[model samples]
Target: MASVYHINKGINRPIVFKGFVAQYIAYLAVGLVLLLIGFAALYVSGLSLFIVLPIILGLGAGLLLVVQRLSKRFGQHGLSKYLARRKVPAFLRFSSRRLFTSLSRGGIIQ
Candidate 1:
């Protein structure tokens, strides 16, 4: 049962994301991909808006939650843990900048 803080602190206890700006870029990349994939999946699968809608909305919500958690407060508040428990679609990736950003306020993005 690894916690977000536990994972953020490297095996050697090194702090991740040492800067905030880098993290912002990382988050932006991930968010964009998710949005794109959701739209793509909808067309590819030929699913109705009702079905595709949840996937798009859920993925976006997850991205928003992570950003909100890290930016609103630079501390461990279990947001990452919540995300980790859920399944992020394969189309999206949780990047390193995103990982570090969520862990601390030391992100590259302002």
Candidate 2:
């Protein structure tokens, strides 16, 4: 009889696609969606292909470059962390002592 074992690694395993991994795949997907939307909008607005094509190409290329940089700078979950971090206040003031002193002075409790 042979014993079989299964190992459960963490959920942080990197996703690989065509030699790219993790955040890079997400970056590409987001860039592709934005590019499609931009080109479709331009086409529907009756813009000539001569103008729309260049604009779309230029914007898509620039956006992909930006995404590549972001993916490189922040690994998997970096974008989420960045968005979450932005919501935090830069300076949090805690004055428990001051609050207690003020409450004591208010005479609410004898």
Candidate 3:
């Protein structure tokens, strides 16, 4: 028989935000790659500049939003709780979820 394991505990550590800043920069780099790819596709397909511009902008914004969320989820232990105690909005809780997925997919904070 084989044994399997799962992680069910939280870690207690300090988050300096330094690493996350680096993570965000990398995310932005990916965003640029996406933009360039969009542009290349449009050029190859002979599509109007106007048609591809919105699609590129939308992709970039979506990527930016994802990076922001990821930083939050990877914050140091008790960081978010401290923020909530200071009256951080309820919407941020949901934002954290989106960020977690983004960071995981982007291979930044995970």
Candidate 4:
């Protein structure tokens, strides 16, 4: 008798669906959920189906397009890296040299 083992080829890879990778899937899901809630709220508020439907549908479509574009542009981790880059200052400023002086003495100023 001979036995064979199956290997998982996708080990250590990001989850991808319909060309969306990793967190982009979650972003699309959350956007859809919010659109659903908006539809429900508008319907309950006595808005006409004709009005509510088109508005929500348009928003949902826009959300899909935007998310897809972002995923394509940013890959898996580039979005996060971009946001982090935005948080970094262009140039750090220090009014005093006390910080360096203390470091040379082997102690922090604060």
Judging by TM-score against the true structure, name the best candidate. 4
Off by over 4 Å in 4: 1-3
> What TM-score number comes out for model 4?
0.93
Regions of candidate 2 where Cα sits further than 4 Å from its true position: 1-12, 18-20, 95-110
Which candidate wins on lDDT?
4
What's the CA RMSD for each of the models? Answer: 21.6, 4.9, 18.5, 1.7
Tell me the TM-score of each prediction against the true structure: 0.40, 0.61, 0.45, 0.93
Cα lDDT tens digits, model 1, 1-110, are 87665444445432334332324446757887979886897768788887877878787888777775674454343445557767666685655667666557756554
Ranking by lDDT, best first?
Answer: 4, 2, 3, 1
For model 1, what is the C-alpha lDDT against the true structure?
0.63
For each candidate, the alpha-carbon lDDT, in order, equals 0.63, 0.80, 0.67, 0.97
Model 3 misplaced regions, further than 4 Å: 1-20, 76-110
Q: Comparing 2 and 3 by lDDT, which wins?
A: 2
Model 2's lDDT to the true fold? 0.80
Each prediction's total of clashing residue pairs, residues at least 3 apart in sequence or on different chains, is 11, 0, 2, 0
- Point out the higher-scoring one by lDDT: 1 or 2: 2
User: What is candidate 3's lDDT per residue for 17-55, written digit by digit as tens?
Assistant: 445543455666777887898789887899887888888
**Alpha carbon lDDT of residue 31, candidate 2?**
78
Models sorted by TM-score, best on top: 4, 2, 3, 1
